[model samples]
Target: MAQRSRVRCGHGRLVALAVMAGSLVMTGAPGASAKGAAGVRPPGDGDTPMCRLTAGPFQRQVEKDLGLPQDGEQSEQDCAAIRKLQNTYGISPADGYAGLVSHRAAVVDWATRHKATLTGCAGRSRRLVCVDQTHQLLWVQQDRKIVFGPVPARTGMPGHRTRNGSHRIYRRVEKFWSSLYDAAMPFSQFFDRGQALHASYRPIFEDPGSHGCVNLRYEDARRLWSMLHVGDGVTVWGTREGA
Candidate 1:
């Protein structure tokens, strides 16, 4: 007999779960979604299959740098959160142990590229905002090293593209409301024209793109708020193809 797990959604709908022969089985509401289950994201149909994904490289990298396992036996709830982070951060969404491995691998890649770009920050001023549009990554660098980040970022979507080029932080506001969409922008640092770099809660990984500003995760935005100031160097480089 399989142990049954039951869950209730935000709207009071019920979900029944079971594990049979080492596989997850959900025999509940026909439209059961991850959003309905404990506020975690559902698993994604990943670019790479689980069988093809490997843990060796990511584990070794994490051990060397962060000194942690890529991931060990994660619970359903934990798996949900892990999946959420991977997708929300634009990392690979391989399932189970493989997904965890891919996430770590992504972190290693970002760190390496971000470090290399720090060379350009050499001999710069007090702060440097390096935006690599090709990678959709943003990191704060200072004096030949990274101060914070290599966080996931997204520029404007296809119709309204983010302008590329070196610019300066002309203005900063902790909280700004956009009349264009009535959206909330936090830790906004305007550099080029009306386009700004601010905290974005929008789900870019889900295919919802931005208008023109560089959208960053909330925590990443908060970090920038504490680190950046008006008149800091903001260099936007590369181009997001078909973005």
Candidate 2:
């Protein structure tokens, strides 16, 4: 049996069933019941909800989210526009979402407030890692161009605020268990004394952040670890200004 979705969305709130805050979980792509042009599942082939706005993934998600009639055809050009929105918002291309047309509009509004500025990283562009604390974003740049990401980040809490200054990656560890906090810090790139850029599973999006570390998602940490090396320059700046 094919499932149908009724999205009661207003003012950016989606009152839908079985949707995670940052992901969409479905047994099959939404509208999986309907077959596409070549009788295929338009966008993705996974059971996961990380939708990338490309030819296959974007179209598939639209079909499911919009319940588009069978035999819908989406051009790569149209998919490219979605990709632009994802990039502009610092959203991962693989972020899963339904009803992309509306989501795209929502992201624009959200990004206007959340996107961090990078111009403060002056004179430190040589193999640099810039952490925008205000927006919880991190990036690796070379020659004034982003090489890796302005990906999501989870920083330290009120008491143990992530240090705000410039430093170098002093160490690298594949698997580190923190004796002080009794937590696991994987793919750690230590810059400050005990603080690091690592992968954490401690509900980073919620309150009370790490003990001064810059925490990233598992995959983001891995990508950073692979791209950065020991002795790379790191700059941490930008306060939340008002509230």
Candidate 3:
């Protein structure tokens, strides 16, 4: 009888686990890669599904579980905070998009729990800010107060899409690709490759394109580099729709 009781307990545990898994699937959590009957991806696969619906308790739960920003939309401040992270850390710019990291769930949870507006801007920080290329603006904030700018910028082509996501600053190279550091100023340690914030003069207003890098005024690039630390945030959003 004792052995039979133990077996029953183990069976009960299995049932509980199954129930939890089912609940997660029904709620549309990330990592639930199970396809539908028609081989189509689930509703929550790409964008943050919770944002589409009205902000409420269910959305709060999803945010807590997934770490995303909540409420109706995304914001410029959010972009800046993510950008600061990307510039400071080594995370890919693509990772800044809403669904790339697990922390988005946490962000969502915090927003909901506090009854705060989900501005979609990552968060407020003295050391972080998001750049929205679509609007040609930079969202800078500290301690929740915000300042906006129509900063001049250049963007990638359609396929490139300026790599929307979070990344961190790993290194700062004064003299990049040349022996003399004085002539060329480039922030060499960005993204995973040759792209960086460097001095360019082909045309300031025109979108002078790079392979996948950000080109800035020499002074602007240096100033930004100086302002950031090794672990600062950086996010690059390609357009206004928060794509």
> What lDDT does model 1 reach?
0.53
TM-score of 3: 0.41
Relative to the true structure, candidate 1 reaches a TM of 0.56
Instruction: Give the candidates in order of TM-score, highest first.
Output: 1, 2, 3
- Looking at candidate 2, the ten consecutive residues that score lowest on lDDT are 4-13
Better of 2 and 3 by lDDT: 2
Per-model TM-score on C-alpha atoms: 0.56, 0.53, 0.41
lDDT of 3 at 56: 23
Candidate 3, poorest ten consecutive residues by summed lDDT: 1-10
lDDT of 1 by residue, 37-143 (tens): 32223445555323222232233333333334434323354344434434444544334232223333355354655466443333255678888666567787777
The digit string of per-residue lDDT tens for model 3 on 145-196 reads: 4432223444454454556776655555655542221223354435434345
Off by over 4 Å in 3: 1-120, 123-126, 146-150, 178-185, 192-194, 240-243
Q: Give the residue spans of candidate 2 off by over 4 A.
A: 1-118, 240-243
